[model samples]
Target: MDDKYYTFSYKLRGDYKASPQYFFVGTHCANEFLDITKHDPLPLFNPLVHEQENHSPGNSPSSSSGDNKRLHPFNQELLTAINMLCISWDIIPKSGLDKIITFTRRRSETPNYNGIEWFNQIVGKDRQRRSLRIMIDQLRENNELKDLRFDESNNYLNERDIVNNIN
Candidate 1:
């Protein structure tokens, strides 16, 4: 199948509209997929006491929770949807998993979906179809992903790639 079919763009709708945003999820577009995942904040699943550490450049995780109540709920459903797509495509790296867990822990303290209107826009019928198509194409391209197999399930792909390159 042509790789172009796997790429998709969705319109962001709201009282304040912006230009259309595109996302690609496929074996050949790992970087693009990571770019999107990295930017999209995941919901904080665990309640960590190191609220101040999140803001600090290099602080211990053992710090006390300061103003932890500020954490608000972002588009967790969207994050999960993206994660399932990543898993289906075997694109998720350890960094991606860490991002999922940490982002959920840190960003959940102050959930902000304003920067990611596409999360909400994806709920629409048309946009949902487009997103699902992208995921479907990714699954079709990777046989391992078809059976729900993950590449380097323990270690993250990005870190593993970096280590292999350095070696």
Candidate 2:
């Protein structure tokens, strides 16, 4: 199956409403769940490989030895949905939208969604909530910068910061 790319855009708030941020997201059609149990082999599908080299510098894993943990079932479902729902996006530093950043597949030596650790890792723990819409909204509301640049700056309001306030 061929991968398809679409131009995704989100409008900023106030004066920036005229010019929205643009992103190129790649997606495919066939991703229906077949209810594979832990014993069943994972389905044969193309994993999301990024085309852009926009990885965030100094973005090391927050986890360490013996820190391996699993998420609650409800949180696991939400994480899985966010991870696998979108294939690939161009933005990187805005990692709240990246797929499987906190937790990874079992085979990759990270916390597996179906592992014995019970899919460990809280979604928004010390990080932005894994969401695009919420991120955009927070960017509009939190940041004084009208352009919505994701650079390392205090002016920009990260969703992680606001999420803590909400909770």
Candidate 3:
């Protein structure tokens, strides 16, 4: 009956007969909570899964290509840089790349927009190459990353190319 706590209850509406469940809110204890939803929940993000996949057998950038020879050193370097940026940003590479492109395009719309100036403002001049902006630019400019196909302006990926690559 404390002022900070209250009872909450819910019940299923269907033919399944069950008593309502009660939850006491406003407990100061950190672990005292229940998930009262009817459906299962999935994680919004899992960095460990991506980290494991990156180090797994045959998942390396060199091995991903078809010719059996390692990827071009520049391509390899770019991929490594991009992977490091992804780790720092705590985002998956595919979605992260998309977000970078979207952010860049939005920034470009301003009158007298300057890519280098804006990027330096956000990431600082010293760390440009290691920053998300530079990593995304390198990825978009590289032809060796066959899974991606950029438009003429390099603003977005072709949906058909992405689907074909996936299959």
RMSD of each: 16.9, 18.2, 18.1
- State the lDDT at 163 in candidate 3: 16
Off by over 4 Å in 3: 1-56, 59-61, 94-167
Model 2 CA lDDT for position 3: 44
Better of 2 and 3 by TM-score: 3
Q: Compared with the true structure, what per-residue lDDT tens digits does model 2 show for residues 48-102?
A: 2333343221112232223444434433333433432232222321333323433
Q: Lowest-lDDT window of 10 residues in candidate 3? A: 40-49
Which portions of model 1 miss their true places by more than 4 Å? 1-73, 94-101, 114-130, 133-167
Cα lDDT tens digits, model 3, 1-167, are 42233234456778345644545554222113323333222111121222333232232333321234333332332333334445455444342343343344344333212322232233332243354434544655642332321122122113223211101
Clashes found in each candidate (C-alpha, N, C closer than 3 A): 6, 5, 0
CA lDDT scores, all candidates in order: 0.36, 0.32, 0.33
Q: Which 10-residue window of candidate 2 scores lowest in summed lDDT?
A: 29-38
- What TM-score, over all chains together, does every model reach? 0.25, 0.20, 0.25
**Shift of residue 86 alpha carbon in model 3, Å:** 0.4
Worst lDDT 10-window in candidate 1: 40-49
